[model samples]
Target chain A: MIEPFNVYAARLLPSQELFAQGHRACQGCGPALALRYLLKALGPETIVANATGCMEIISSSWPETAWGVPWIHVAFENAAAVASGVEAGSKALRRKGRIPDKKPTVVAIAGDGGTFDIGLQALSGALERGHDFIYLCYDNEAYMNTGIQRSSGTPFGAATTTSPAGSKSFGQKTWKKDLAAIGVAHHIPYVATASIAYPFDFVEKVKKAAAVEGPALIHVFAPCPTGWRTPSNLTVRLARLAVQTGMFPLYEVENGKYHMSVDLPFLKPLDDYLKPQGRYRHLTKDVIAVLKKGIDQRYNEILEKCEANHE
Target chain B: MAKAAPQSLRKGIEVSISMAEAAMQANVDVVAAYPITPQTHIVEHLSELVADGRLDAEFVPVESEHSAMSACCGSSASGARTYTATSSQGLALMHEILYIASALRLPIVMAVANRALSGPISIWNDHGDIMAERDTGWIQVFVENGQEAYDMTFHAFRVAEDHGVLLPYMINFDGFILSHVIEPIVYWSQELVDQYIGLYEPMLRLDTKNPITMGPVGIPDIYLETRKAHDFVLRESKATIVKAWDEMEKLVGRRYRPIETYKTDGARILLLTMGGVSETAMTAVDALREAGLPVGLVRIRLWRPFPFEELYEAVKDCEVLGVVDRCLSTGGPGGPVASEIKGALYHKDKRPKVVEFIAGIGGRDVRVEDFQDMAKKTLSVADGAPLPPFELVGVRE
Candidate 1:
């Protein structure tokens, strides 16, 4: 059984919103939950340069707004670029006394499609520049807005509109791109993988990302109930299972040292996580076994990294 | 009043020299670019300035045209008034990102050495690259000489970062023509530019104390609407462009208009062109007038907003138009500039029969004699076989 979201995450995320209300997001969208926790952890005085995604559309609709602080929706790929611009603009303004020195912290948010595909180059450029900004890539596995096309972030055996469960189909044939590893390779100030299943742990990673002065990236595994074809209420439960099963592990990299936030007692069967969601309903035993084998290999490697970080 | 002189000044200093010196005076914070042909001298001078500490800017040596703009984007977004230069193939490589920069509205300034696109990769002067990107939401200004390049580049920062028009801009200097060839340029002092355009006061920024969510996902119902709003703002922001130029005029004594005219005062034939080709086109008109042909020239300075009204009034009464286009429009009957020029004049009462000439493309050498050739070709068509305004000087089979 899953714990109630409000009761379980109270200590981690405050009731007050940094994202605020009135910004239009789907009822209980995973990205919103991710933003809620991220905002609480980072606190206020943070300016956001959002991209052209579901979050930007709903919150920034004219005459109605969801954000409590300063925010902008520049473009899909240029969120990191725009955030960097605002960061530079504010800093330069402060030095010249053109703007008050009390500048808000800049944070950029993008969905899986934007982060994993369209905006990848801009994100790479920002990280390379070592701009003091936090890039939050809320991975919902597929392009939820554009009618559930398979994004690079989508995992194997997951069914999407593009990767349909029709004749001669293996669902999404590729595994999710290891974005956290790529980010870590940049030797960024911070790189972390999180899930809404563990709100406190997620919040903590966000806090760590915010505190770092250089480029930081936080990837949150946000389950899409609509896109994943799962019941909305079972979102958190499925996400929590995703972690315990070693499918989407929760971990952080602190100054190049890898730290696993949760280490499971025993690996749960891959079928347990896959069976409930319609996205994975057509998965055959062979496909499940193959996925399990890859997951096991990757998990063992992660454990080796954890063991190596025995400080 | 004391310094202003004739439109033609004898063999002036190269525009690149004045551009380098203007940037030096502007006290730029960052100059990051990879040099392409035609744009080489501008960056060469910039690199030298940073090397000698003449300008206090972090000059990042980027690998490619994509990264050149990428570095500028990074540096500019970080609140630095960054500058970069590119043309032709280099500009094409930065094509996808040009839209990205404008949409993000980073307020970056790029000096574009306008060159033709490649099937044949010519490095000479043309407006193909810039014309292809006319609708990319960048505030583009075409300069005929080095003096304009010197003034426009500094003015770009003002127009781009203006609170009302927070858009990135590209100041186009014709490849080889203006970017390579030297001309007398009046260099303005930094004190005036600084006083005219103060430091950027960014509305939303990245800092530690305050945190907010940005760049969220926009769904279908709102996506089109949001894009429509952005499109509307870009088009309607023409007034802001004029206002910025006017304010800059107060500080520096020069002013800019969308469509610049030369002897259009009651002329029957009007020769039209953009960028450095305007000089050649004007020379053609002068020769035609010396032989008693009533011809004038109209130069399009601002490409974005199209300057339709100014163009309409400028060429309304003209009987014949020799519009030289540097870019091809595959789907349409002719090139991009020619098509727009014809379209803008279509609604006029005493409309000119516009003859589209595909000239100086792929960096092909366009001499002043080419315009004289083109003007003669245009008048012949106007006199008898004016087949509904179409392409003339194409590289035909």
Candidate 2:
């Protein structure tokens, strides 16, 4: 039996150490923490195909790797395909009495740039092939690597390199892509959006995704200090504000059923999630209000879907 | 009866094809490729074979050229002996992953109906596509006709999967010139194909039980060393390629050599080319010999590890060489072949003054007259006359 869910009380850290501390992860890098929590849920049986991103570079440097189990660092775009190969390869090897384990979890770690952009095709192929694997996209709202160039995942009205605030204003004119919705459209066994702000919800989704027999996608809203332009300490707080305000929802889809994991009692203003991030520092109040309009539209859409799915 | 048997009679149909029939006869697991002009006939025939249950294969109808190659990569990487084909822009679109295929050393083989690259969008014959991808680290083989195309695709699997190599190979044919043009070809029986090529049970795969990661990135410090390992394997695999060919000959009754020599016993001039263009040089060589000129023709098959030792022996008796590179290097001296031959012959005790020509770019059809002119130009260069420098043929713009 478990106690009534409280963020502090729900914290049940695992005994097995799949992610070692003192290994490089940016100060409060959400993806790194996501990795930590994901590993906790997965225990030591998971093998990760970590893509090239802020977390991969910082943690898996030359001297040593933060990963405690079997790991591979493939190129940026082929993480999903590589993971598919690993899953298929491992199965064949085991059946032939080559590898000892009868079953092992395979997961692919991709960033916003990798998942939303360059790696989309490979992801689609693996998912369509119905490969047994979990693909996690740590969305920090922009391409944090390469000094934060604008990616398709970057939010509207935010100033990025390509979408900078100029005389024309409205730094990024395009709204953030509804990646979780797109995942749902894949008709996968499981598709969910999880935020680091709610670690327990995120971990539950990870465990669910890992257990599914076919393709599963977990879209995690991560906060970056360098790209988000927030202070290191404010990363988690901002992520919390994001979910609390409904700007980033904590939800899941198990075989096409939509369910909200985090039930926020009181919603905060969207600016609380936006204010500390340097990526959106240039946005005027008017622009922020417009962004709120888009977020409202999205939340309404998600709510309607939840209603429709339940009915 | 002994007199009627004739001195040296070889039946044309008794010769095995190097391209089309190998996959069908081998009962390949998958054959997924888009039909781009010349290569279409090959796959069309292959498709019919699969439909007829002659070849046990999954002919996946993919979305595009990229998907076709991607499907091959996925299928082959998953322990299936997969086959695919492309030419020119189709090849160009797969450029990004071509490197990946070789780097992963996936042992996938593709037939390129060697069409020219686009811009003007010509659909004729040229080495434009294959030449551009020379350094892609694939064991590239240029066949003179349809026969070699069928043979090499079969041998490619053996040579590629030979744990010593484990690299992908590309068999190049001069698009419509050879790919669409067919001749009587002997089909190897399935049992013989099995005995010759052997069954490839993969040593590694993507499985659930023994989980392992494939295609990992090595950071800067180890990147160069990794590249060096790939290069060394590519070089060392040359011996294995030859050995595979010799074994193939015993079963199929046709032998293969990297560099082929024709009438060069005491020749002074050697005419060189690849693909269907070799026949043109052979014609020009006959004419040169008719005119009492000491000329020979050396046709190159493998272009990647570059049959250096074999080429040296082939051209050792020659003084002046005429090299035709259908694709442009675009910079430095002239065509790619001209530069390669120069490098190979640089330290020789007695070397030939190789005259290079860039011909048939963008599928400008090269005629027999062009070869005759090429041979005449070679003789002019040999005679120390002011050569029209190494010219780019059929250029009007």
State which candidate has the highest DockQ.
Answer: 1
Give lDDT tens digits, candidate 2, residues B322-387: 898888766667888888999999999888888888888776778877887887788777788665
Error of 1 at B268 (Å): 4.2
Query: Model 1, which residues run further than 4 Å from truth?
Result: A1-12, A95-97, A101-104, B1-17, B20-86, B89-108, B120-123, B157-168, B199-257, B263-268, B381-396
Model 1, C-alpha of A246: deviation from truth (Å): 1.0
Candidate 1, residues A193-276: lDDT per residue as tens digits? 999888888888887888888989999998888899988887888888899999998888888788888978898888889988
Q: For all the predictions, what are the DockQ values? A: 0.22, 0.22
Please report how far candidate 2 places residue B339 from its true position, in Å: 1.6
What digit string (tens of lDDT, one per residue) describes model 2 on residues A1-311? 12244535445767566777876667878888888888888877777777778777776765566777667664677677666655655554455454575577888888998888987877887787777899999998777877787888888887887788888876888878778877888899999998887777888889899888999999998888877777899877888888888888788888888887776666798877787777778888888888888888888777777778878
